[model samples]
Each structure stands twice: as C-alpha cells, then as structure tokens.
Target chain A: MTAREEILSRIRGALGDTPSRPDVPRTHRQQGVHRPGTPELVRQLIDRLEDYRATVVRVAAEDDDAIGQAIADALTVRGIGQVVAPPGVPRAWTGRLADVVVDEASIDARTLDRIPAVVTGSVVAIAETGTIVLDGATVCGRRAITLVPDTHVCVVRAMHVVQTVPEGLQRVDPRRALTFVSGPSATSDIELDRVEGVHGPRTLIVVVAG
Target chain B: MSTFLGMPGVPVRGPAADTAVGHLTGDRPFPAAARDSLADTQLRRNLAHATSTIRAKRAAVVTEVPDWEALRDAGSAIKADTMARLPELLEQLEANVVARGGTVHWARDAAEANRIVTDLVRATGADEVVKVKSMATQEIGLNEALEAVGVTAHETDLAELIVQLGHDRPSHILVPAIHRGRAEIREIFALEMPGVDPSLTDEPAVLAAAARTHLRQVFLRARVAVSGANFGVAETGTLTVVESEGNGRMCLTLPETLITVMGIEKVVPSWRDLEVFLQLLPRSSTGERMNPYTSTWTGVTPGDGPQEFHLVLLDNGRTRALADDLGRTALHCIRCSACLNVCPVYERTGGHAYGSTYPGPIGAILTPLLTGLTGGDDPNDSLPYASTLCGACYDVCPVKINIPEILVQLRAEHTEAHADRHRLPTAEAAAMKAVAWSMADPARFARAGRAAALARHGIRRGKPLLPLPPPLNGWTASRDAPRPSAESFRDWWARTRGPSS
Candidate 1:
C-alpha cells in the first residue's frame, strides 16, 4: 500500500470503533438577520461594513454601463488608472471606462503588477458580522484578483446577504475554493498596533448593488 | 543526501517529550526570574492597548447578533462532546479521510508527530517545505525536528517570518510577532532577508512589500507544505485553516505534498458544527466580523491540489489532559485567544513570560494539568501562583472555562501534593485554619471575633499588621497592606446599632 494508505490504517487503528452518538443536534441554531428582503440586508451590511472603516458605494444591479461608469468614476476619484478583472467579469461593467486599462484574467503577473484595483462579486454576505464571503466564483472572480490588487471592490447583490455565520457556512461548499473577508486584510502584530492592508488588499471597497 | 549538510542536531526526544516529563514530574512552573517580567511597563502598555482595542471591537460585533450567546454555548458544547468521545471520533475521522483518499497518522506525542512529518518530507524527497502558522507545530517543536533531518521549514505567514528571522519566540497566539513593532520588523528584514532593499522603512506598506518579495520566492520554490488546522470536521473528513494573509492559500495550493499536524482534540463531530465556531472564532480572536481567509480541504482532487496528503493526528498529552474531569474543559479552546486578551497577568508579562506556547490564564491552568505537577523543576510549582485571580480570563473566555476557579483548584492541588516540600505560611491560610477550628463551636467563634477586635488597637496608623509572612510575599510584593479597622466591622456595627434597631 502507499504511504497514504498506511497512514490511514494507523489512524483507523488508533481511533478504533465509533463511539455512541451525542444527544446534541449537529446543526447550529440559525440566527440570521430577519431582514424584510435582500436589499435591506445588503444596505445593513454596507452600513455595518462602513462602520469598520471600509469604503462602500451603491450601484445599479443590471445596468452594466452604469456599473462600469460608477467603477471608473470611483477609480478616477481615487487617482487610479489601471484595473484588473477576472475572465468571467461582465464586460458591461467595463465598457464605459475606456481610460482605465482593463487587464484580462490571462494577463501575466508583470502586467497585473501595474493594476491598482480589482472589482468582483461576492459569494455571500453575513449581516450579523457585517462580513463578506468570496470564492473564485462569479462576481468575486479568482482568489488572486482580490489578493494581488492594492484595492478590492467587491460587489454584493442584496439577495446574497445572509443573517449569521452559520447561514453563510451553509451556502459555502468546501469542495470549491473559498475566501471569507471581513474588512480589508489587517494586522495588529506590531506592538499590538493595528495596521491595515498589510499583505492582501490594503483597502476593501464594497459595492452593495440593490 | 545534499540536505544533510546544514542540519541541526536532533535530540533523542522531541519538545513534547520534554513537556511530558515536565508534566509527569509536576516540575515545570513559573520561575522566580519571571516575577520581574510583570513589571515591564512598556509591555504592559502594549498589551493594554492591543487587548482593549480587540475586546471593544469584539464586544461591538458580538452584540450585533441576537443569538451570539447561543452560538457560544453551542460551540463550547460541540468541542466538549468531541473531546469526550475523542478516541471514537478520531477513528471515524480516519476512516472517512481514508475513504476520501486522504491519509491520517496518529502521534502519541510531539516526538512521534515530528518524526512522522519529517519522514513524510523525506519520502517526498523535498529539501524545503513552506509552512502556514500552526500552533500545533510550535507545540511539538516540528521546525526543530525538521531541521535535525536537514529539511528547511520556511514560515509563510508574515508575522511568523519575522519571528523566524529574529530567532524569537511567539509572544501572542493570533499575532506571533505582537511584541515587535514595524521598526523592529524592518530591522529584522534588512538583516535577514537576502537581497532586501536597503531603503526599507517601518511604514506598514513598505514592510509588507518587503516580506512579500522575500516570501514570493519561497512560495514558488517549495514542493512540500505543512500546516495546522483551526477546526477538523470528523463527518466530512476536512481540515479548516483561517488567516488574514493569502500566504496560507499559496502554501496550501502550491505544495506538491501537503502534511498537516493537528491535535486530536481539534476535531468536531461534523461539518455542521462549524456554524457555531465560525461565528465565535473570528470575532473573539481578531475582533473581525469574519476572518479574511478561511480555507477548507477534504482529501485530494485528481489534478487540482496536492497529490499526496498526510494528516498527523497528535495526542501529545491531550488524553492525559482529558482524564482530569475538571480540567478537560480546556480542550474546548478553539484558540481564538479571547482569554489571553483579557488576562491582567498576561497583559503585563506578555506571552513569553509563561514559558510555554500556551500562555495567559489558559496556559496557567493548562500547562500544569498537561504536565501534572508531580515532579520536576521549581517553575511548574510556581505556575499556579502566576495568576492574580482577577477572574478577567473567565469573563472573556468564549467557551467559559472558569479560569480563576481552575487556578485556585490547581493551587490547592499543588499545595496538597507538595505539602512537606514547600509549605506556604499565608496569614489568611492561618487565620482560616483558626477560624475553622473555632467554627466547630459557636462560643469559640464569638470569642475569636471579640479577641480580633481587641487586638485591632495594635494596628498602626496606615500599615496593617499581617499575622503570617514569607510565601504571602507574592501578594504584598506590589500592593500596600490593607490596614485593619480600629474595631471589627461586625463588633462596631453591633455596638453602634442593635441588630433590629
């Protein structure tokens, strides 16, 4: 047998027979926000996120032209010129921003090195914690898009927001890659001083599209 | 064969072995030298600032949820249940992992765990391995083990890299380099990083970029990776790792052979159990609504991730810890580090003063329990006295470990076991003994209180006279002696106002 098999056999032997079942329920109590709907949840999530020092914006959900224009306007206001987007990102979101270079997913790291911001969608949003969960799924793009860029603009639809962490975990299947971001990547390691945007995105901008 | 050239010497026993002996002899305690550490004002200020900020943030976010209490309870219960049935769940976990094409290795202690990981790396013919921030590895001293075998363990986490470069021990659980500021980090980077820019500043971005540049090469080059899990789900046979840095993702994916060393107690009964912990861990630890990076992998996929996966399930002293009914609840710790943030003693002395990977209130109770204070050096006996019995650790504990109660209990045990060797002559203990003897008769009890009042005139203007001394010096060392009143409160009250007046 292979090393994996041998290791497994040892584990099996060490563990022995299965024990009696616990009386407690396996699933946690669902304590999600009782939002009237997805839009309210998204707005609430945005408000809570903003409280954490995250920059938030509101945009149209279906108007790719407006979405692109808004992103371009935001980037221009921030004095950024280049942006990176995953391959599956809707072209409509980029159509209006001609001056902003839209680096494609297949672009090499050298080219991506020039980009200042990346816009994508989130897999889920947790209202209770004001957190956004993203995988390399639609909108949220690949993990690198959110990680490598200096600024991350994650778009969350009102419909995708959940009430609590448990609800969020249920929506995320472990088989696929997942990244759960609360605020921007931060550290307090330095003399217990909080310094934001250390290794991941220095700034996380949430675009809550209703 | 080339890997053996720069190797460090491997002791016959691993770090766990030393700890086990320490545990067995009941000898490893806080040393007298550590007493001075509690007076470090700079460390106190740093810890005060760090812990307060995280505590406030945690309280704010935690209160946002209506059922957060329920979640905390559930999380504690799940962990308790898992630990109670650890032997069986471990077997189930192994079977499920094997069925899913994953491998599991059982380590009786740290030495066994380290050997398994080192041998696994050797089998893969990898000279170097990238590492994620794993407390288990630190607990078992895996890096030292790997080094002895000529395997270079490169820490991928930014803070961990700083610790590795500085040759310093981790000072905080969540932030290993918490004791270091940006200036210190920059200095370490300049001195240790190969081809690092000379103009590096203490600016956050500059330091992070330097670290990124340094690690990017290692990430691209390493063929083997090792990690520890935050949570191990038995039902799904999965391991979960959470971090703010993307390095964990890089290390988890980039390596060809992945080895994870997890404490056996890390297991939860099922994936669904994640709900309660997912809520409790992030907020309690970093004061974030959610962790920035959470990665979960169950076995191997054909072409997607590491082709060979090995999970070393380590017991170390967990079973021994489990046998003690009152102490076993410690296993419920998700390592969220909430208790450390609120512990007054820890805030002043910092993590290094504990002399163990586990520190603060949790370490105070845990280290002695795991090591079982039977024999060994003076430090082990001293650990029980390390606490101020402030009860702050219990309040902030997400799992509600009742740290102060446990500390007192351990102190009693320490005193009882080592009664003849080092007897404490505490004034309060002597007073209590007298009171206990008098309390057997109501007449003697009444006379004792009256006599105590008559002796009150001897009390000095400001300084109170404590009846006994020496071992009680631990308390009086820093505090002003509380003066006894001119008359006992009970007698004064009775003389001034009749019982039913």
Candidate 2:
C-alpha cells in the first residue's frame, strides 16, 4: 500500500469512530473589535505598532491629498530618497515626491533592493493585532515589492480595517500571497533580545486613513 | 520514480536505522547525559538566564489578556478536534494544495522524508539550498543527508545559523543556541563566516548586521529553499510561517522552488481557526502580542515567489504517538517551548540533557512515546523520570497538554514492562516491597522501624557509611544519607499518650 493509504489507515485505526470533538469548550474572545475606526481601538492599534517601533500615520479616509502629503512627509522625514510602488497606488498618494519609481511587478529582485522604500495599499488591516495584510492585489503589488526594500509604507483605509484576524482574513484573497506585518523586521534570536533590521525591510510605516 | 499519483515516499524503522534518525536519537539515558550537562557551569548559567527571561515575559503578557485561559482551552480543543478529524483534514489539505499547482508528498518516517527532499533538491540540480529554521528538517537530519549527496544546505535563521556555524546541537526550541553568549557568537562569526568585519563586537545590532550582510548574496542567488510550516490551513491550502527575521520570507519568496516539511499534526481546520493559534502562539512562545512578520501563501502565484511549491506531510512517529489515547494529547504540541521555559528541570539541565530533538517536559513524555520504550535498553525510558512533576509545564502549555499526568503514566508503564526482565530480584524492588509491606500494618511498621534503627547504629555522626551497599549506594553517590532516629515518631506518640500516663 502507498504511504498515504497506510498512514490514513493508521489514523483510522488509532481513533476508531470515537466521538471526541463535541466536548471542546470554545468560549474564548474571538473578536476584539467588530467595528472599524472606533477611536479607542485605533488608538490601541497605534499603541501596539509604536510598541514594536513601527511608525503610524493617521489621515482622513477619502482625502487623497492628505494621504499624498502623509506619504511624502514620511519619506522626507526618514530621508528615503528613492521609493518604489506598483503604479496602481493612487498617483495622489505619490504627490510631489522627487524620486518615486512606480513599476508593477516588472522589477527584478536584485534591482528591487536598490530602492530605499516601498509604498502600497493594503487589502485589510487588523486593529487588535496591529497588522497590515497585503493580498497581492494590483495596488498591493507583488510579494517582492514590500519585501526587498529597506522601508515599507502601506496605506490602509478605514473600511479595510477590521477588529480581529478572522474579520481581516475574510477580506483577503486566499489564493494570493499574504504578508502580515505587525512591526518592522525584527528578531529576538540573539540572547532573546529584540533587535530590528535583519533581512526584510527594517522600517515599516503604516498610514491609517479614517 | 513514477510521477502519476501522490508522492509515495518510503518508510523507515527498526534498530538498524537508529543512526539515520540523527540527533533525535540519543545513546545515553537521561541521567548520565544530564550529569555531563550539569557539569558545565556555563551551560547552567545560560539556561538559567534565558529560561528566566522568557518565563517572566510570557507571564506578563499572558496575565494581561483577560481570556488567556479561555484561549488556551480553545486552542487545546481546536487541536483535539483537528487530530480526531486529521485523516479527513489531511486529505482535504492534500487536495487543496494540489489544486493550487503544488505537489504533495507523504513521508512514513525520517529516512523516507529525507530521501524525498534530497531527490527534490537534486531534481532542481541546485548544489546549494537556503533553509528556514524547521524542527521537522532537523529531526530527520535532512542537512546531513544532503551533505552526503554533495549538496550544501545553509541555515538562514539567526539562531540556527549560530548552531550550524559552531557545529553544535540546538539547546533550546526557540533560541536553539541559547547556550552561547554574545562573545561566543562573535567568535563563531569571526572564525566561520567569510568576509565578516574584523571589528564586529558582541553587540546584537552589530551581530545582526554582520549576518544580514553575509546572507544577502546567498539569498539572492539561491534557487531552492526548504522550510517547515507552522500551520497548514485545510480551508485554503495556505501554509503560514511565523518568524521574526526576514530569513523565512527570503526563503519562501525568493527561491524558484519551495518545499515545506510539516508534521501531520500542524494542520488546522480552516482559515478562521488560524486566529486562535496566531493569537495564542505569539504571546505564549515569544511573549509578543503579535510577531514581527507572518508570511502565508496558498501555492504558486504566477510571477511572484516560488513558481513550484511542494508540501511534504511527515508522519515519522506521529502515528505511533496517536495510537495511545492517554498519551496522544502530546501530539497537540505547537513546538512553542513554553513548557521548557517554565520547567525547573529544563531550566537547570538545558535541552542537551534530554538527549532528543525535543527536550524538557514535552520531550520527556514525547521521546519515550515516539521511540516506544516498552522494555529495557531504551535511552528515552529515563526521560519520564527527569521531571519533578511540578505541573508548571502543564500550567504554561498553550494547548493544555497534561504533561505531569502523562509523565507519571509513562513511569508506571516503564516499571511494569521491565518488572520481570531481570533473573534475580533487584535490591531496589526488594526494598520497595519491604517498605510497602511494613507501611501496610502498624505492628509490622514498628518492627521495621526498630530494624532500621538497629541498622542505623552502624552509622557515625548521623551520616551513612562511606561506599554504601547496593540500592543505598545510589542515594549516597549524590549525598550522605542521614541515619534513622533512635525512636520512631509513632513510638514516641504511643508512649506519651499511653493510658498509664
């Protein structure tokens, strides 16, 4: 018999039709927030992001000009001279940037690393965990866009912000690549001490638009 | 060699193949191994400091969550549910992964799993492959197998890199090289890694930078990457890797072909079910509200990341572990090492003392069950006795595995199986029987006490005689045994409360 058949038979032999799941009591907090843009919960999200040393920028949901201004300001403040995006990100968000290079999935991994920062729009955001999810949408670019660069600036709209991971999962396209960033690239492997900037982008900036 | 149906890998077993199992198999019983580990003050200091830091961090975060216990219960429940329905869930997972343009392989044991992976890397014809830190790969000794075939595997995780560079075994689950300090780390990098800066200090940032610079060229050029999945979601066939450094992301996304070796127990029912683990694991393992990065992919995504993906479902000793109803709950382990951090024995002796791929409370129960210590000559038989049964492991276990209860059960199993193995009645068993008989009756107990006192008369200054005799020598080997009191407590009470008084 094939290994799969033998293994499946073994599992069947081990647990012979004994019902064991009905007694699993699951009374845990499933959703910390069901609504989006609650001031207190957003503040909580900001608190978590800052705790992990990721910068957060708040903006009005529909104000493209303000979103543009926020992105430019973040890049300038960090001295990120060259930025890369997928070109599907609203031109308004890249307003007046001197060295913004927008290309959609055409850049090679080698040259992609030369850029100082990456700006993209997120598919969903989780407030409870302070996470931003990229579903490889046109605006989100490919997986390599946010990864190879040293800085990642993701724009999350209020409607896309969810209270729990489950709610956030509901919005993402499961077939596409999903990168969940809670903070900048970090590691605690060295003596279990938290040290940032290992391989992926060292700095993460989340622009939360309400 | 046929490529029609599923990847039907081979099965490996028996004592002859023990060496094929690599570090997962140990030669010495836990006691002897622990003696060596305990002798190293450096190891003791490292284990004490690292375990204490993680323990405090875990407690602080777990205490902050109002539903920590509830989450733990739900986590355990979810795992149990997954296991009960594992056969069906695994089938579903296989189907989903295949549908997403990924190949799925079934490994019956360690040797077969190594064979499948080695062949896959060979097919790619890449002489070198970068790897994400994976216990499944380590357990099977995949790197050594690859090396024998002239393929080099580079460990990319910072801790794993430290272990590989130093030619040492992993000492902790989370921090594999926790036994090494900053100074040792610097020395390893300076001696091992080519092009490392001469001025590199023991500072973590400087160390991290040195690694980043060193691994960048390799990550960019590598065509094949090997990994282990934290969770295989049956709902979407998505494999998720939760990691801090970008090494995991680099391996998963940069390579042309990606292969993941996952234990059958790592599967969950659905995407929604992922929330519980995502929340429970970070807080319980790393003591973070959320990990720095979590990368999830369903399979091939046309022009992005690895175009060819393969999922190898491993069942090395899992089916055997699943056979026992009382001991099977151990399969629910998430490999978080929370039990190890909080275990007093593990904190003192470190992971090497356990003498297995897994260590501490989990390894104590797990290694024996996996290896099947039904009788004599099993190195893992002594592991069940390594713990103090403090229940700290169970308390901190995210999935609520009752480790203490299982440890006691295994001890009983070991004793009963080996009871008649000897031709002569051993002094230890004989002494136990005598003690039991004496304690069963009041008069007999008094007589036994008198006998003990008479024997104690041979002692000098309340200490047992040097070079003590059989069975008694085991105790005296560690410390001098105190002589018995002249009058038993029972006798003293009887005389004082007698009717004549």
Docking class of 2: medium
- Among incorrect, acceptable, medium and high, the docking class of model 1 is acceptable
lDDT of 1 by residue, B1-501 (tens): 011111222211111234742122222345544555657666666667777777787788777666666676677677767855665677778887787788888776677788889999999999899999988898888888889999999987888889999998887788887766677788999999888998888886677777777877676667899999988888878788988767777677656788998987788888778777777888888877777667777777554457788998876666545555566677778888888888777777777777777777888877766666642255656677788898877776777787888788888877666654546544555767877999899668767777766665645653446543565555555665555555755667778897634
**Which segments of model 2 are wrong by more than 4 Å?**
A17-19, B1-19, B424-427, B439-443, B455-462, B479-485, B489-501
Chain A structural similarity (TM-score) per candidate? 0.82, 0.90
Q: Over 4 Å off in model 1, which ranges?
A: A1-37, A48-57, A63-122, A135-155, A201-210, B1-31, B375-378, B420-501
Q: Per-candidate TM vs. native?
A: 0.81, 0.94
**Lowest-sum lDDT 10-residue window in model 1 chain A:** A11-20
Q: Looking at model 2, how many pairs of residues clash? A: 1
Q: At residue B117, what lDDT does model 2 achieve?
A: 95
After best superposition, candidate 2 residue B203: deviation in angstroms? 0.5
State candidate 1's DockQ. Answer: 0.25
The two-chain DockQ for each candidate, comma-separated, is 0.25, 0.54
Candidate 2: tens digits of C-alpha lDDT, residues A1-210: 787887776666666556376456767765664576677667777888888888899996658889989999999998877889886899998876888888755677888878889989988778777888887778998888888898999898877767776677767776788898888888887778889889988889988888
The ten-residue window of minimal lDDT in model 2 chain B covers B7-16
